[model samples]
Target: MNPAKVALVTALAGGLSIGAALLGERWIDPEGGGIPLAGLGQGEPVQWPEIRLPDLAGHEHSSDTWSGHPLILNFWAAWCPPCLEELPRLERFAQRHADAGIRVVAIAVDRPEATRAFLAAHPVDLTILLAELETITLTRRLGNRVEGLPFTVAFDARGRHVFSHLGALEQDQFEQLAARLDAPSATPR
Candidate 1:
């Protein structure tokens, strides 16, 4: 083939490969990380999905059951180091804020055995619910289409989303969140 023809073919192939990767990423992560607070209105009330799943002990519960209390819902997996590191902090935060009507709920997107084993080695007081592999869709519903581990979403007493974050959270961040949760609730719209 002529040198010019070879260069043209290579450029076209490279462009096609880049396009495919971008499309795939978008398909998998609709929310992506570009907009952390996208789709959620500021101070606007939005109803969260009714997430029903079983606790480590097998008791069933739903997200609505935690209504009237500020909730910090965290999606984690046993295999993720960051998720494991943040579990204890979340547990302590939940205990400290129990009197303030704040609850921390952890949803594990891992096999039951794996989650149980991890908990056994590193115990926590916060309720750990099993979402297993279904957590991919469940996290997306909670505005975490990036599917990153240790993602957290905070809801006000009215069950409206107040904050969301991806990646590991530091102690100070948790403290800040606790303060926000303890604040007076705004009138639901």
Candidate 2:
């Protein structure tokens, strides 16, 4: 083989190998944000990790506060439009389900002032928890691969994670969640 041809072939092979490696990396980590995927499963019993954050009123809270009861854990941000759009419906859901021992909790991943402002104007009747970057970590722990806004996680009366949604919860989804949590034997959805 000619010397120039041999060098060209080797360069091409190396380039292709590098390209394949880059493609594989993207497939494994789509967002390139370096969050390891938990691959959380539906119906799989999961323990909620202990997280401490302040509320709009500047009261500190731990995740365990919502334990021992059915909970709707929503991870949202003030900048997310979908998150904002779903707040009213979630508030209504919380109000309707509050008597049934279901606690709706919203964990906001934004500055306290922004969250307070948004809540002050919108007025959601649910527990709000403020977090910084840990909000994304919490969402990932709950099986949100994309860490998208409006992520919701549901826990049964026993405090086992039963359902998780990564996008805005539709009305039907909220109703179905209510039914599942209200049932004695809540199955994974």
Candidate 3:
């Protein structure tokens, strides 16, 4: 790839990593068992719970669409500066990985009007899901009661939890994520 392409990918991964990490993690409700992702040394497969939310265009998004692929589910809000800074990188990540069977899904945690206004000014190509009333329920169910926006959760091809970063992502970090796209291929079918 050209320098620009390389730089772009690096930025996407790094931006997401940084922004999300700076936001840090929300302590999961002890009552709510957190879904284990990485740094746990947990050998179990990742599980992506079913989520149904509206898209920016008012269309419903079935989280199952991301099934059978490495899903990079990102959470953000328009009021969030880090998220706004990382939009383009995330969009580019989605485009390049479209053919790689990896999906980048952005869930807007803001209200409809705010989300609409943000989308209007900064159009993006990724499927922007709305974390509406239903999403709130799902977030709680997913052990995100403390609710940290600008979070990036990666799931394996089988919908198993892989890894997650809680801040802005840079290009290198993103490539590491993209590397996951090739991970399943290493396993026996």
The reply for model 2, stretches above 4 Å from the true place, is 1-44, 186-189
Q: Using lDDT as the measure, what is the rank order of every candidate, best first?
A: 2, 1, 3
Clashes of each: 0, 0, 30
Query: lDDT of all the models against the reference?
Result: 0.72, 0.72, 0.68
TM-score pick, better of 2 and 3:
2
- Tens digit of per-residue lDDT, candidate 2, span 85-184: 8888898899888888888888897778888898888787788888767777777777765555667888787777667765577776788778878887
TM-score for candidate 3, please give it: 0.71
lDDT of 1 at 64: 78
| Candidate 3 Cα errors over 4 Å, as ranges | 1-46, 134-145, 185-188
Which pairs clash inside model 2? none
**Model 3 over residues 18-106: C-alpha lDDT tens digits?**
64465334322233333323343245544787888888668887877766677888888887777888878899888988998788889
Q: Score residue 60 of candidate 3 by CA lDDT.
A: 85
What is the total number of backbone clashes in candidate 1? Answer: 0
Candidate with more favorable, higher TM-score: 1 or 3: 1
